[model samples]
Target: MTGTTDTRPVHDGHHTVGELVNQAGEQLSQLVRQELALAKEELTEKGRRAGRGGGMLGGAGAFAYAGLLGLAGTGVAALSLVLPLWAAALIVTAVLFAIAAVLAVTGRSQLRRATPPTPEVTIGSVKADVEEIRERAHR
Candidate 1:
Protein backbone atom coordinates (compact mmCIF):
# COMPACT_ATOMS: atom_id res chain seq x y z
CA MET A 1 0.00 0.00 0.00
CA THR A 2 1.10 3.61 -0.75
CA GLY A 3 2.23 5.75 2.22
CA THR A 4 0.02 8.74 1.26
CA THR A 5 -2.78 10.41 3.24
CA ASP A 6 -6.22 10.85 1.67
CA THR A 7 -6.98 14.62 1.67
CA ARG A 8 -10.02 14.24 -0.59
CA PRO A 9 -13.69 14.69 0.27
CA VAL A 10 -14.92 12.14 2.84
CA HIS A 11 -18.39 10.82 3.82
CA ASP A 12 -18.90 14.07 5.73
CA GLY A 13 -17.54 16.56 3.28
CA HIS A 14 -15.36 19.35 4.64
CA HIS A 15 -16.42 22.94 3.86
CA THR A 16 -14.44 25.06 1.45
CA VAL A 17 -12.61 28.15 2.72
CA GLY A 18 -15.26 30.42 1.20
CA GLU A 19 -18.08 28.41 2.80
CA LEU A 20 -16.38 28.58 6.21
CA VAL A 21 -15.87 32.37 5.93
CA ASN A 22 -19.47 32.87 4.87
CA GLN A 23 -20.72 30.79 7.80
CA ALA A 24 -18.54 32.79 10.17
CA GLY A 25 -19.86 36.07 8.74
CA GLU A 26 -23.44 34.88 9.09
CA GLN A 27 -22.86 33.83 12.72
CA LEU A 28 -21.22 37.13 13.53
CA SER A 29 -24.13 39.01 11.98
CA GLN A 30 -26.61 36.98 13.98
CA LEU A 31 -24.67 37.61 17.17
CA VAL A 32 -24.58 41.34 16.56
CA ARG A 33 -28.31 41.42 15.84
CA GLN A 34 -29.11 39.48 19.00
CA GLU A 35 -26.91 41.79 21.06
CA LEU A 36 -28.58 44.88 19.59
CA ALA A 37 -32.04 43.43 20.32
CA LEU A 38 -31.04 42.77 23.93
CA ALA A 39 -29.73 46.31 24.26
CA LYS A 40 -32.95 47.75 22.91
CA GLU A 41 -34.97 45.64 25.32
CA GLU A 42 -32.87 46.78 28.27
CA LEU A 43 -33.15 50.42 27.32
CA THR A 44 -36.91 50.17 26.90
CA GLU A 45 -37.29 48.52 30.29
CA LYS A 46 -35.13 51.17 31.96
CA GLY A 47 -37.09 53.96 30.27
CA ARG A 48 -40.38 52.49 31.51
CA ARG A 49 -39.02 52.23 35.05
CA ALA A 50 -37.76 55.79 34.91
CA GLY A 51 -41.15 56.97 33.69
CA ARG A 52 -42.91 55.20 36.54
CA GLY A 53 -40.48 56.67 39.04
CA GLY A 54 -41.03 60.18 37.67
CA GLY A 55 -44.80 59.73 37.87
CA MET A 56 -44.52 58.62 41.49
CA LEU A 57 -42.32 61.60 42.30
CA GLY A 58 -44.82 63.94 40.68
CA GLY A 59 -47.66 62.37 42.68
CA ALA A 60 -45.68 62.77 45.89
CA GLY A 61 -44.97 66.41 45.11
CA ALA A 62 -48.65 67.06 44.40
CA PHE A 63 -49.65 65.38 47.67
CA ALA A 64 -47.08 67.45 49.55
CA TYR A 65 -48.43 70.66 48.01
CA ALA A 66 -51.96 69.68 48.96
CA GLY A 67 -50.83 68.94 52.51
CA LEU A 68 -49.17 72.32 52.76
CA LEU A 69 -52.33 73.99 51.55
CA GLY A 70 -54.38 72.12 54.15
CA LEU A 71 -51.93 73.17 56.87
CA ALA A 72 -52.21 76.80 55.81
CA GLY A 73 -55.99 76.59 55.86
CA THR A 74 -55.83 75.17 59.39
CA GLY A 75 -53.44 77.94 60.47
CA VAL A 76 -55.78 80.57 59.03
CA ALA A 77 -58.73 78.98 60.85
CA ALA A 78 -56.76 79.02 64.12
CA LEU A 79 -55.59 82.63 63.73
CA SER A 80 -59.10 83.80 62.81
CA LEU A 81 -60.30 82.57 66.25
CA VAL A 82 -57.94 85.08 67.95
CA LEU A 83 -57.10 87.79 65.37
CA PRO A 84 -58.40 89.78 62.38
CA LEU A 85 -59.37 87.67 59.35
CA TRP A 86 -57.07 89.49 56.86
CA ALA A 87 -54.05 89.25 59.21
CA ALA A 88 -54.72 85.55 59.71
CA ALA A 89 -54.83 84.93 55.95
CA LEU A 90 -51.53 86.78 55.45
CA ILE A 91 -49.83 84.77 58.18
CA VAL A 92 -51.16 81.54 56.68
CA THR A 93 -49.87 82.57 53.23
CA ALA A 94 -46.38 83.26 54.66
CA VAL A 95 -46.31 79.90 56.38
CA LEU A 96 -47.44 78.14 53.21
CA PHE A 97 -44.66 79.83 51.21
CA ALA A 98 -42.07 78.62 53.73
CA ILE A 99 -43.38 75.06 53.47
CA ALA A 100 -43.29 75.29 49.68
CA ALA A 101 -39.64 76.37 49.79
CA VAL A 102 -38.72 73.38 51.93
CA LEU A 103 -40.58 70.97 49.67
CA ALA A 104 -38.92 72.50 46.59
CA VAL A 105 -35.49 71.86 48.09
CA THR A 106 -36.35 68.30 48.93
CA GLY A 107 -37.83 67.67 45.48
CA ARG A 108 -34.73 69.13 43.85
CA SER A 109 -32.52 66.77 45.82
CA GLN A 110 -34.67 63.78 44.80
CA LEU A 111 -34.40 64.82 41.15
CA ARG A 112 -30.64 65.16 41.50
CA ARG A 113 -30.49 61.57 42.68
CA ALA A 114 -32.10 60.41 39.42
CA THR A 115 -29.67 58.76 37.07
CA PRO A 116 -29.26 59.79 33.42
CA PRO A 117 -29.89 57.36 30.57
CA THR A 118 -26.91 55.21 29.61
CA PRO A 119 -26.00 52.18 27.50
CA GLU A 120 -25.81 48.85 29.31
CA VAL A 121 -23.38 45.94 28.89
CA THR A 122 -25.08 44.58 25.75
CA ILE A 123 -24.63 47.84 23.89
CA GLY A 124 -21.06 48.19 25.11
CA SER A 125 -20.22 44.69 23.97
CA VAL A 126 -21.82 45.25 20.59
CA LYS A 127 -19.83 48.44 20.14
CA ALA A 128 -16.63 46.62 21.01
CA ASP A 129 -17.40 43.89 18.49
CA VAL A 130 -18.07 46.47 15.77
CA GLU A 131 -14.77 48.18 16.54
CA GLU A 132 -12.94 44.89 16.34
CA ILE A 133 -14.60 44.04 13.02
CA ARG A 134 -13.65 47.45 11.64
CA GLU A 135 -10.05 47.05 12.79
CA ARG A 136 -9.82 43.59 11.25
CA ALA A 137 -11.29 44.87 8.00
CA HIS A 138 -8.71 47.64 7.89
CA ARG A 139 -5.87 45.23 8.44
Candidate 2:
Protein backbone atom coordinates (compact mmCIF):
# COMPACT_ATOMS: atom_id res chain seq x y z
CA MET A 1 0.00 0.00 0.00
CA THR A 2 1.03 3.61 -0.44
CA GLY A 3 2.56 5.47 2.53
CA THR A 4 -0.35 7.90 2.81
CA THR A 5 -2.50 7.66 5.91
CA ASP A 6 -6.23 8.51 6.01
CA THR A 7 -7.87 8.78 9.44
CA ARG A 8 -10.79 11.16 8.93
CA PRO A 9 -13.99 10.23 7.18
CA VAL A 10 -14.74 11.74 3.79
CA HIS A 11 -15.35 15.47 3.75
CA ASP A 12 -15.30 18.37 1.34
CA GLY A 13 -11.71 18.83 0.33
CA HIS A 14 -9.21 21.20 2.00
CA HIS A 15 -10.83 22.28 5.28
CA THR A 16 -10.11 20.14 8.32
CA VAL A 17 -12.69 19.31 11.00
CA GLY A 18 -11.36 21.86 13.48
CA GLU A 19 -11.38 24.58 10.77
CA LEU A 20 -14.97 23.76 9.88
CA VAL A 21 -16.05 23.86 13.52
CA ASN A 22 -14.32 27.20 14.06
CA GLN A 23 -15.87 28.64 10.91
CA ALA A 24 -19.29 27.48 11.98
CA GLY A 25 -18.82 29.06 15.41
CA GLU A 26 -17.77 32.32 13.87
CA GLN A 27 -20.72 32.35 11.48
CA LEU A 28 -23.15 31.59 14.30
CA SER A 29 -21.70 34.43 16.36
CA GLN A 30 -22.05 36.85 13.47
CA LEU A 31 -25.62 35.76 12.81
CA VAL A 32 -26.58 36.30 16.46
CA ARG A 33 -25.05 39.78 16.46
CA GLN A 34 -26.85 40.73 13.28
CA GLU A 35 -30.18 39.49 14.61
CA LEU A 36 -29.74 41.49 17.82
CA ALA A 37 -28.97 44.62 15.81
CA LEU A 38 -32.04 44.12 13.67
CA ALA A 39 -34.22 43.70 16.75
CA LYS A 40 -32.83 46.89 18.30
CA GLU A 41 -33.48 48.86 15.13
CA GLU A 42 -37.00 47.53 14.81
CA LEU A 43 -37.83 48.34 18.43
CA THR A 44 -36.36 51.83 18.12
CA GLU A 45 -38.55 52.61 15.13
CA LYS A 46 -41.66 51.31 16.85
CA GLY A 47 -40.90 53.36 19.95
CA ARG A 48 -40.56 56.54 17.88
CA ARG A 49 -43.85 55.93 16.14
CA ALA A 50 -45.53 55.20 19.43
CA GLY A 51 -44.14 58.38 20.94
CA ARG A 52 -45.57 60.45 18.07
CA GLY A 53 -48.95 58.79 18.48
CA GLY A 54 -48.96 59.46 22.22
CA GLY A 55 -48.04 63.10 21.59
CA MET A 56 -50.96 63.52 19.24
CA LEU A 57 -53.27 62.00 21.80
CA GLY A 58 -51.99 64.41 24.41
CA GLY A 59 -52.67 67.31 22.02
CA ALA A 60 -56.21 66.00 21.55
CA GLY A 61 -56.69 66.08 25.30
CA ALA A 62 -55.53 69.69 25.41
CA PHE A 63 -57.91 70.71 22.64
CA ALA A 64 -60.77 68.93 24.37
CA TYR A 65 -60.01 70.89 27.52
CA ALA A 66 -60.09 74.09 25.51
CA GLY A 67 -63.47 73.06 24.10
CA LEU A 68 -64.76 72.56 27.64
CA LEU A 69 -63.64 76.08 28.52
CA GLY A 70 -65.45 77.40 25.44
CA LEU A 71 -68.58 75.56 26.47
CA ALA A 72 -68.35 77.21 29.90
CA GLY A 73 -68.02 80.55 28.14
CA THR A 74 -71.09 79.70 26.07
CA GLY A 75 -73.06 79.07 29.26
CA VAL A 76 -71.95 82.41 30.70
CA ALA A 77 -72.80 84.23 27.45
CA ALA A 78 -76.19 82.54 27.21
CA LEU A 79 -77.06 83.59 30.78
CA SER A 80 -76.02 87.18 30.07
CA LEU A 81 -77.97 87.61 26.80
CA VAL A 82 -80.11 85.18 24.79
CA LEU A 83 -78.77 85.97 21.33
CA PRO A 84 -75.50 86.39 19.26
CA LEU A 85 -72.81 86.00 21.90
CA TRP A 86 -73.83 82.49 22.98
CA ALA A 87 -74.18 81.41 19.33
CA ALA A 88 -70.68 82.55 18.58
CA ALA A 89 -69.36 80.79 21.64
CA LEU A 90 -71.22 77.63 20.60
CA ILE A 91 -69.62 77.86 17.15
CA VAL A 92 -66.15 78.19 18.61
CA THR A 93 -66.74 75.26 20.93
CA ALA A 94 -67.96 73.15 17.98
CA VAL A 95 -64.82 73.99 16.06
CA LEU A 96 -62.58 73.07 18.95
CA PHE A 97 -64.44 69.76 19.40
CA ALA A 98 -64.09 69.02 15.71
CA ILE A 99 -60.36 69.62 15.86
CA ALA A 100 -60.11 67.34 18.87
CA ALA A 101 -62.02 64.62 17.02
CA VAL A 102 -59.68 64.81 14.09
CA LEU A 103 -56.65 64.64 16.30
CA ALA A 104 -58.08 61.66 18.20
CA VAL A 105 -58.76 59.75 14.99
CA THR A 106 -55.31 60.39 13.59
CA GLY A 107 -53.67 59.49 16.88
CA ARG A 108 -55.66 56.28 17.16
CA SER A 109 -54.60 55.27 13.71
CA GLN A 110 -50.97 55.88 14.51
CA LEU A 111 -51.28 53.87 17.71
CA ARG A 112 -52.88 50.99 15.84
CA ARG A 113 -49.99 50.91 13.43
CA ALA A 114 -47.56 50.75 16.32
CA THR A 115 -49.36 48.01 18.25
CA PRO A 116 -47.95 44.52 18.71
CA PRO A 117 -44.54 46.08 18.79
CA THR A 118 -42.15 43.21 18.09
CA PRO A 119 -39.24 42.69 15.81
CA GLU A 120 -41.29 40.90 13.21
CA VAL A 121 -38.78 41.04 10.41
CA THR A 122 -36.00 39.90 12.68
CA ILE A 123 -38.16 37.08 14.01
CA GLY A 124 -38.87 35.85 10.50
CA SER A 125 -35.25 36.09 9.53
CA VAL A 126 -34.18 34.16 12.61
CA LYS A 127 -36.78 31.49 11.93
CA ALA A 128 -35.52 31.14 8.38
CA ASP A 129 -31.96 30.92 9.63
CA VAL A 130 -32.94 28.18 12.08
CA GLU A 131 -34.60 26.21 9.32
CA GLU A 132 -31.57 26.57 7.09
CA ILE A 133 -29.27 25.48 9.87
CA ARG A 134 -31.44 22.46 10.54
CA GLU A 135 -31.38 21.52 6.85
CA ARG A 136 -27.63 21.84 6.69
CA ALA A 137 -27.21 19.83 9.87
CA HIS A 138 -29.32 17.07 8.46
CA ARG A 139 -27.27 17.05 5.30
Candidate 3:
Protein backbone atom coordinates (compact mmCIF):
# COMPACT_ATOMS: atom_id res chain seq x y z
CA MET A 1 0.00 0.00 0.00
CA THR A 2 1.06 3.62 -0.50
CA GLY A 3 1.55 4.53 3.14
CA THR A 4 3.52 7.74 3.16
CA THR A 5 1.73 9.73 5.85
CA ASP A 6 3.28 12.94 7.12
CA THR A 7 3.98 11.29 10.44
CA ARG A 8 4.62 7.67 9.40
CA PRO A 9 7.20 6.61 6.81
CA VAL A 10 6.06 3.23 5.56
CA HIS A 11 7.56 2.97 2.05
CA ASP A 12 6.84 0.43 -0.70
CA GLY A 13 4.69 -1.76 1.57
CA HIS A 14 7.82 -3.58 2.60
CA HIS A 15 7.69 -2.83 6.32
CA THR A 16 7.22 -5.88 8.54
CA VAL A 17 4.43 -6.04 11.10
CA GLY A 18 6.98 -5.46 13.88
CA GLU A 19 8.19 -2.30 12.12
CA LEU A 20 4.61 -1.04 11.82
CA VAL A 21 4.05 -1.69 15.51
CA ASN A 22 7.21 0.26 16.30
CA GLN A 23 5.92 3.19 14.23
CA ALA A 24 2.62 3.07 16.10
CA GLY A 25 4.49 3.22 19.38
CA GLU A 26 6.42 6.24 18.19
CA GLN A 27 3.23 8.02 17.13
CA LEU A 28 1.60 7.24 20.47
CA SER A 29 4.57 8.69 22.33
CA GLN A 30 4.42 11.89 20.27
CA LEU A 31 0.67 12.23 20.84
CA VAL A 32 1.09 11.88 24.60
CA ARG A 33 3.79 14.57 24.72
CA GLN A 34 1.66 16.99 22.68
CA GLU A 35 -1.39 16.37 24.85
CA LEU A 36 0.58 17.07 28.02
CA ALA A 37 1.78 20.36 26.53
CA LEU A 38 -1.78 21.39 25.70
CA ALA A 39 -2.90 20.62 29.24
CA LYS A 40 -0.08 22.69 30.74
CA GLU A 41 -0.81 25.67 28.47
CA GLU A 42 -4.52 25.58 29.27
CA LEU A 43 -3.91 25.43 33.01
CA THR A 44 -1.38 28.25 32.88
CA GLU A 45 -3.76 30.59 31.02
CA LYS A 46 -6.53 29.86 33.51
CA GLY A 47 -4.25 30.59 36.46
CA ARG A 48 -3.09 33.87 34.92
CA ARG A 49 -6.65 35.11 34.45
CA ALA A 50 -7.62 34.18 37.98
CA GLY A 51 -4.52 35.92 39.35
CA ARG A 52 -5.38 39.12 37.46
CA GLY A 53 -8.91 39.03 38.81
CA GLY A 54 -7.59 38.59 42.35
CA GLY A 55 -5.33 41.61 41.95
CA MET A 56 -8.33 43.62 40.83
CA LEU A 57 -10.16 42.47 43.90
CA GLY A 58 -7.32 43.71 46.07
CA GLY A 59 -7.42 47.08 44.31
CA ALA A 60 -11.14 47.29 44.93
CA GLY A 61 -10.59 46.56 48.60
CA ALA A 62 -8.01 49.31 48.89
CA PHE A 63 -10.20 51.90 47.18
CA ALA A 64 -13.14 50.83 49.28
CA TYR A 65 -11.14 51.36 52.46
CA ALA A 66 -10.16 54.87 51.37
CA GLY A 67 -13.70 55.80 50.40
CA LEU A 68 -15.05 54.41 53.65
CA LEU A 69 -12.65 56.59 55.60
CA GLY A 70 -13.87 59.65 53.73
CA LEU A 71 -17.51 58.70 54.23
CA ALA A 72 -16.95 58.11 57.96
CA GLY A 73 -15.52 61.61 58.30
CA THR A 74 -18.58 63.04 56.54
CA GLY A 75 -20.93 61.00 58.73
CA VAL A 76 -19.31 62.23 61.93
CA ALA A 77 -19.58 65.83 60.73
CA ALA A 78 -23.26 65.46 59.94
CA LEU A 79 -24.21 63.64 63.17
CA SER A 80 -22.25 66.03 65.38
CA LEU A 81 -25.03 68.61 64.90
CA VAL A 82 -27.52 66.59 67.04
CA LEU A 83 -25.10 64.82 69.46
CA PRO A 84 -21.73 65.15 71.18
CA LEU A 85 -18.70 64.91 68.95
CA TRP A 86 -17.44 61.65 70.53
CA ALA A 87 -20.83 59.89 70.13
CA ALA A 88 -21.10 60.90 66.48
CA ALA A 89 -17.58 59.68 65.75
CA LEU A 90 -18.33 56.40 67.50
CA ILE A 91 -21.45 55.86 65.40
CA VAL A 92 -19.55 56.47 62.19
CA THR A 93 -16.75 54.15 63.31
CA ALA A 94 -19.21 51.32 64.03
CA VAL A 95 -20.85 51.60 60.62
CA LEU A 96 -17.49 51.67 58.87
CA PHE A 97 -16.37 48.58 60.76
CA ALA A 98 -19.49 46.70 59.63
CA ILE A 99 -18.82 47.53 56.00
CA ALA A 100 -15.22 46.46 56.32
CA ALA A 101 -16.24 43.14 57.82
CA VAL A 102 -18.63 42.39 54.97
CA LEU A 103 -16.02 43.14 52.34
CA ALA A 104 -13.38 41.03 54.09
CA VAL A 105 -15.67 37.98 54.13
CA THR A 106 -16.58 38.39 50.49
CA GLY A 107 -12.95 38.79 49.47
CA ARG A 108 -12.00 35.65 51.31
CA SER A 109 -14.69 33.71 49.46
CA GLN A 110 -13.49 34.95 46.07
CA LEU A 111 -9.87 34.09 46.84
CA ARG A 112 -10.88 30.58 47.83
CA ARG A 113 -12.71 30.13 44.55
CA ALA A 114 -9.68 31.14 42.46
CA THR A 115 -7.33 28.47 43.78
CA PRO A 116 -6.25 24.99 42.52
CA PRO A 117 -6.16 25.89 38.87
CA THR A 118 -6.27 22.55 37.05
CA PRO A 119 -7.24 21.80 33.47
CA GLU A 120 -10.31 19.70 34.23
CA VAL A 121 -11.83 19.89 30.76
CA THR A 122 -8.58 18.80 29.11
CA ILE A 123 -8.23 15.93 31.53
CA GLY A 124 -11.72 14.68 30.73
CA SER A 125 -11.09 14.99 26.99
CA VAL A 126 -7.85 13.04 27.27
CA LYS A 127 -9.57 10.32 29.28
CA ALA A 128 -12.28 10.01 26.64
CA ASP A 129 -9.68 9.81 23.87
CA VAL A 130 -7.78 7.10 25.71
CA GLU A 131 -10.95 5.08 26.16
CA GLU A 132 -11.82 5.43 22.48
CA ILE A 133 -8.38 4.28 21.50
CA ARG A 134 -8.70 1.29 23.79
CA GLU A 135 -12.05 0.35 22.28
CA ARG A 136 -10.72 0.54 18.72
CA ALA A 137 -7.72 -1.55 19.63
CA HIS A 138 -10.00 -4.20 21.07
CA ARG A 139 -11.81 -4.46 17.74
- Show where candidate 3 strays beyond 4 Å: 1-17, 105-115
TM-score against native, each model: 0.59, 0.60, 0.72
lDDT of 2 by residue, 23-133 (tens): 999999999999999999999998999899999999997998798887767665765575577676666667778978998999899998875767999999999999999
Q: Which numbered prediction scores highest in lDDT against the true structure? A: 3
25 Cα displacement, candidate 2 (Å): 0.5
Clashes of 2: 0
Clashing residue pairs, backbone N/CA/C < 3 A, model 3: none
The positional error of residue 79 in candidate 2, measured at the CA in angstroms, is 9.7
After the best TM-score superposition of candidate 3, give how far the Cα of residue 58 lies from its true spot, in angstroms.
3.0
lDDT (CA) per prediction: 0.86, 0.86, 0.88
The most accurate candidate by TM-score is 3
lDDT order, best first, reads 3, 2, 1
Task: Kindly list the per-residue Cα lDDT of model 3 for residues 1-139, writing each as its tens digit.
Answer: 5976587775787887888799879988987898899899998898899899999999998998799789888999999999999999999888878977998999899998885767887888789879988997898
lDDT of 2 at 96: 70
Total backbone collisions for each predicted model: 0, 0, 0
